[model samples]
Target: MSCEECCQRRGLGGRMIPVPGEVAAGCGLAWKTAPEAREELVAALEADGVPVEAMTVIELLEFR
Candidate 1:
């Protein structure tokens, strides 16, 4: 299953947070849910040569 689907199964609100760079695609997870795996995601992007300046959680009222 896709990451989005997997996250959804875990009851994570769906929202996409920007990755470090355009080199890698972004994700589909709400900031709240995304924050849970923020460290791992940032690490992966950084390791892929993407610029990881910051990794933070933003509370979004809407999914779009």
Candidate 2:
């Protein structure tokens, strides 16, 4: 997330759930979401002109 204020600006509030492993890895913060939602998320970001190349999609090994 950009900042605590970012969520409020985007009206995302509680929707921006935190990812577990990211904080442990010192990655600051990440969005918690299901693997199946990847495509829709990517499409939404792209549609909003958010450059998504820097977005990393990590699939849990067990899910694979």
Name the top lDDT candidate.
2
* Model 1: lDDT to the true structure: 0.47
| True lDDT of residue 3, candidate 1 | 45
Error of 2 at 44 (Å): 0.3
> lDDT by residue for model 1 over 1-64, one digit each (tens)?
2444444545545455544233234753222344577656544444555454444555545555
* Cα lDDT over the full model 2: 0.48
In order, candidate lDDTs are: 0.47, 0.48
lDDT of 2 at 5: 40
- Candidate 2 lDDT by residue in tens digits, 1-64: 4432443455443344344463454444555455666666655555556543244556533352
> TM-scores of all models?
0.40, 0.43
What candidate 2 gets wrong by more than 4 Å, as runs, is 2-24, 53-64
Best by TM-score: 2
Question: What are the per-model C-alpha RMSD values against the true structure?
Answer: 8.1, 6.7
